[model samples]
Target: MRALAYFKKGDVHFTDSLPEPKLTSPKGLLISPSFTGMCGSDLHEITDGPIFMPKDGETNILSNESLPLAMGHEMSGYVKAVGPEVTKFKVGDRVVVEATISCVDKHRWPNAKNANTPMCDACKDGCENCCDYAGFSGLGVVSGGFSETMETIEHHVVKLPDFVPMDIAALIEPLSVAWHGARVAKFTEGKTALVLGSGPIGLAMTLVLKARGAKKIVVSEPASIRRELADKFHVETFDPSKHGERAIAELRSIPEGGNGFDFAFDCSGVAPTFNTGIAAIHYRGVYCNVAIWGKGINFNPMDMTLQEKNLTGSIGYTVEDFKQVVDAFEKKKIDPKECEHLITGRIKIEDGWEKGFLELINHKDTNIKILLTPNNHNELD
Candidate 1:
């Protein structure tokens, strides 16, 4: 089967020599992936990793995988085969793969099935996203969505509606990420929000907020194309570059009364954006960190304390988050027309670097959600 594999930092290659995956567990299913979306984390992995992608000779405690890893986690596929004990899914079931792997008991079955297996206090508390040993399936597990196929535990697959196209279905994973942050911040209808960036995750947050009935959404970004993309969704946009020293003040003015936003999300993961998000929220408002930060930084806790504001961090999504996103689409809260706009373009696995990753990295402002299909290429819609 053809697959995209990592050779070293900044190098991902296409290969047809990798062996086809076989169902190894009674709880596993073989997925013939139709579409996969590249994620920001994937970019980080290819560029500077060995971060999440395991090194040679070192096994991941959860998936037991090492280097030469398969990439691409945001994916949609159809079931080609299933293990003997798998009852919920059968041949030809369309589904999306959730990349998070939990439970990971090293002493027992290190790479054992962890779908419904809660091995941590967080998972035990119904917060699997907070699971201590949570590892991504694509980054370090068996293989990823970049391949022609993936062998995933039944617990990690969610059935997709027939009405949902595979192209759009591939977005479930990333959308679930934003959905989880909204859920964590307890976002309510008619509330206002400030998004720190207009990248894919930030844009997804706007869509989730709008579908959830946010009264006013303000997306702060410097990139004109990104801001324009957010504007197409009717979201009010602010360019921090335009405001300069008064960017926070300008952001505060977007919501009613110039007081502050009801909720703020930092999706850029930069220090300035983090500070801006913290400063832009109303007193007692919730601040959520949606991006994966490059490095930890020092911030004054007094800023959080004086306003009695809530600062929380959200990582991967839970099974429930994916379910809610699917439900959002089904209920028509998220318009398919609008969601489709998020998919800027598509490329073949062979062109993953030039057309997909490099294009995104260099011209990120003009692109979003570029899907990589194993079979063929897809031009911008």
Candidate 2:
């Protein structure tokens, strides 16, 4: 097995002769990954830089890499094997790895708040995703989709219908992320939405809003390509560069002079976007934060109070989000060319650390999500 691994003290690199994972119980599936997208966090884990450095000497979401572990989480693959315990899935099925492993425990069900709180809200009664014991992958703590293969619990896999391409399946994880935000917003077909970024997450949000039947979708972005892509989707795009307008100003011009979005999803997690979300939401509207902004900033709670705006946060997705995304793709709603447009570059697994993952961190403005393919890894070669 040619697994892409972190060269402990050096840049990320791979080696030949990686060990194959033994088949576990019936609860697991062994998948041969077809495509894996390099993520922002993977680069963060490899660098000893700020933001997400390794802690406890062995665990940074990227560096704690369970060394030499394979990486790549946003991916799609074919099930090569299934444990006897698995019931719904079978070998040769194309699926997207959901990338979270969890089990139930009481005192932590239906949390709906605080994902890292070491308790499952759903697990207390047999529901997971909010389980008291939530185990997530691509955390740099667990083996990832970067390698040629992954042994994931059956529940973590979402089977894609035949109509969806394998390449598009790689996007399921991130699409789920956007779906979760929409879920938090409690979107209905006729509601208005504004996605505050043109990045991959932001673009996904735009896609989701359209599929969910948003009456009017506004995507605010400065990048030319992203703005164009949003336009291609028939979304009303707000380009910040040309107008120098804040998000609030853009929405105000829509018709109602700042009546605001029914559901505002902040994808940039930037201070400006936050302020805009607060200022532009209608009364009783929901503002959901899905972007991970690390610092706290000054904002008037009075604004939220006066408008009756509901403030909420969504972490990652439940398995249900993944399912909804696959179904969206199966319905021919997810355009393959549009999905591939989100990809800016592709690199071999061997170059992932130094060249691939590294580029994701330093050159974000130039790329959306860089993908790493085992198509060039030595084991397969």
- Candidate 2 residue-wise lDDT, 16-96, digit = tens: 766776554457778888778876556656664322223335543221233455666787878889888789889988788
The weakest ten consecutive residues by lDDT in model 1 span: 104-113
Instruction: Looking at model 2, report the run of 10 residues with the lowest lDDT sum.
Output: 104-113
Best by lDDT: 1
Q: What ranges in model 1 sit over 4 Å off?
A: 104-118, 376-381
Kindly list the per-residue Cα lDDT of model 1 for residues 1-381, writing each as its tens digit.
888887667878888887777776788888988889998888888777877777767766665556777788898888889988888999988888888766632222434433344468886787766877766767765578888888888878899877788899888888899999999999999999999898899989999999899999999999888898899889888989998899988787778888999999888999999899989998999999999988988899999899999999888898888889999999989876788889988788888888888898998788889998975422311
What would the TM-scores of all predictions be? Answer: 0.93, 0.85
The positional error of residue 15 in candidate 2, measured at the CA in angstroms, is 2.4
Task: Please list the residue runs of candidate 2 whose C-alpha ends up more than 4 Å from where it truly belongs after superposition.
Answer: 7-10, 48-65, 104-119, 125-135, 241-247, 255-258, 375-381
